[model samples]
Target: MSYQTTETIQRLWDDFLRESLAEVPPEQRQQFAQQFEDRFSELLQNAANGGGDGFLDLVGFGDKGPVEFENLPYPYVQPDFDDSVVPSQLHAAAELYYIYQHERMKIFKVVDVLLKLFRLGKMRIQRGPGARALYLVEKWKPLRYGVRDRMIAYRRAFNYGSSKAPAGAVTNVNFHRQLVGLIVAVAQYFRDLQVSEVIRGGPMINQRPFGSSATVQRLGIDLRYALDRSTYGNIFALTMEVGHYLNSILKLLDAPDIKKAFDANTKWNVIEVVSNRYLGGTAEPSQRAKMAESGRRILKFVADNNFETSIDPHLFQTELRPIGPHAEAWLAAYRTTPEGQRFPGVPTALRSTRNRKSIPV
Candidate 1:
């Protein structure tokens, strides 16, 4: 679907104004139309000028509101992994790096989908709890972890003999928890949209009033096509795996031997120490960049070719050739360890596989 640009937005505003003013009495219509047009034109102009907060706020969809985090229960069960692999610090680092990259890349895509929905007028947010929840999602940005920052963390946590690791590479012990909270917030926003009656079952474009009868009739289509079942399923799968990987990583970091190896006092310290040790080298810079790029491509691939549909291997290989070498390298290193020899294959987080199961919205 074509995104709404400035020109299209102005056209949409003009159409909406013309339709709305048609109901006014002929004697007073000219004055009313003039006033309405002036106000709406200003709003459209602000939105076009990257001052969307003003326009969105006027339409009751602004980001300047209080948002309450939903204490929603996460229902996905953690996948089982062998305890024998817990002592493999390299394996733990691999999982940590993989999941962190996944989290970083996924947020941009989520924002993209959200922005598209809002721009197309597929999702309407009036002033309420729902608006606040959506505001939280819109304002959310991933933590600023650059290549050097991540590499330092990895080295500190994994390489015990690195003293020259960069300063300012701190770790958030609650990183996983925070990410899970964002997931909950997103789910809450979707629920709010449904409850507000902004989304309904019908033809993509229909005459039925959405949300409130008093609201303007938007020219946009239903949001279902943009955020379909496949999209939700993929999100579910990704989040569930993330949670699983995070739990495993947390356990590894918290292990007594791991803490003693690095003289770490807290989970954050363990991360800082291990990361500094393992990733404090010149070669890591290029590797880290490749991993990040590969991560983005993988996410895009999954989003485009969802689990419900069969993916073409040739196309997948062509698009994700860079990932194959990295995945193989990690696998090869992992196989050198005793746990890898016993339980062979790509780790859960690194697999280019998809599941057909759907999670409850």
Candidate 2:
């Protein structure tokens, strides 16, 4: 996808990548080397699927030349929805984003905040206005945690230790809290030094008596290095890539030697729970009817024997195996649900054959 950042900012991003990679040091890279390769492969897949020529040129395996930032087909800009007036499942999503940008939480802390929102079942990322920016919590998985660390080794080198936190460790609660404090301190330090102004925005519209959207943030010593779009987007994509690589990561961690990425006290067992919050979908107060309808179409498509490649049980067992435990259950239940056949979008004729709902996530 074409980046929305300025050409100048994009050039700076390339330079930052070079510097960050240099700073990782050989010893550290050795630890996550296998993961880095797997993660890179995943990123390559996403870039191919979602990015345009610019991304292909800048990030491809061995393209070493002047950086090209313009002339790439841009990601279509969608207007920010008047989230204040709309019914949304994203109240928690907005809250988390507000907290990260204003509260300056580290990437992991932001993920935890998202988990809380997931339990509450709030909005998915609001495609504010014209899809100006998507803010889904889909990026808060263990893979995302790994991606964040790998990103440190390659993009935000200086930002680490001084800007964010130390490099070469797994994401955990303690580290998240520490990183949040560190980022805030860095912002304060720069503000006190008169290098830059702290940034701020929002009053969560659905504010309970105590909840509010008012928040602030500041990049540090250099205005260029602030945790703004450039830093956030790169890391965000890496997070998605990581989430997608969950299968590979879990496989790697299965070996006793690779499990060290988890800190000594870590307790998050990777459970396969179907969370609406995580998928940017919620069962309560969300457009579940819409999702259900969407889900049905998918079920039909998968069930269709005419497809170029039939989406069989084998496909589910293979491709979506990570989230399978839940996806399979949902599909079965929905196919049998009283309202399953009544969903809006399903074609009537095919409805009978697909009356049974079994979708693999």
Candidate 3:
């Protein structure tokens, strides 16, 4: 039997989707979503799909560290392995880096919910090389410890690169282990809960890993993941959601200009450079070679719009719910839950610096 919290969470998730679907223009629904489905599919194939690269790469079982890239450029820069780079520009793309850095911790929390959903889907916890833990306490841990690139590895044990990094970077290889470690940690939580097991007629990993409308309602698992909760909310927050959100932002800002801007950038766009470097949207050079015509066009449109204004959720609506009794919705759904709620009794517009004052002392 599902818990009440789970049921409530699932309902909220489904309602959010239903509402979002209703708001979507009919023309944008069937055709435009094709690209999202394709991109999401690739994300699955590369990582979260049955033992895919997304999930397998982060096992961190034996030795955990970042994967060592042979052809890539500089492998090290800052201390504690802040592989995070400052973009040369500060438009939408640069904001992405800032968003990611700020929301790095929150990502872990959201990933935890996905693990639970996987369990509910009856998918076994994907085990990586060796048994290692992914945690950051006193100081910064390398990205390998809690993050994974978009692939699996037969590379170094525990480390993905050379342990001889130059004062910065992920201390050379084997970080794949760290990435894997996080996956395990997230899975372990649901395994312990016992509520993650698959129920009859429930969504299964192979057929439908992403809980369906009914499933999300029953489980109360919100799939939203926002970087800056103060700025945004649980609704429409993940990278994929960002793409959709950006589309909405453009329509609201300058719906007519969208086509014009995109037409001009048919060959290129600043967003292309930025998203490629940060948001990791659109397709890679390899994918571009094999992309279908529709896929190419969708990528082009997505790249052109960055949702510059009204990034704030309040401008839209309080998509993020309050965290509490119905919080099971959080474990199952991503951003649908309220686990990352900006503590109450504070100005919603507080900036990062001034934002600190709002946090109860």
Best prediction by TM-score? 1
lDDT of 3 at 226: 13
> Which regions of candidate 2 are displaced past 4 Å?
1-158, 161-226, 232-237, 251-361
Point out where model 3 deviates above 4 Å.
1-174, 195-258, 263-281, 284-361
After TM-score superposition, the amount by which residue 213's alpha carbon in candidate 2 deviates from its true location, in angstroms, is 5.1
Return the number of clashes found in candidate 2.
Answer: 29
RMSD of each: 26.5, 28.0, 30.1
> Residue 325 in model 1: shift from native, Å?
42
Across residues 82-135, which tens digit of lDDT does each residue of candidate 3 receive? 112211211222233222322322333332332343346432223321001111
lDDT against true structure, model 2: 0.33
**Better structure of 1 and 2 per TM-score:** 1
Residue 156 of candidate 1: its Cα lDDT? Answer: 42
Model 1 misplaced stretches (Cα beyond 4 Å)? 1-235, 281-361
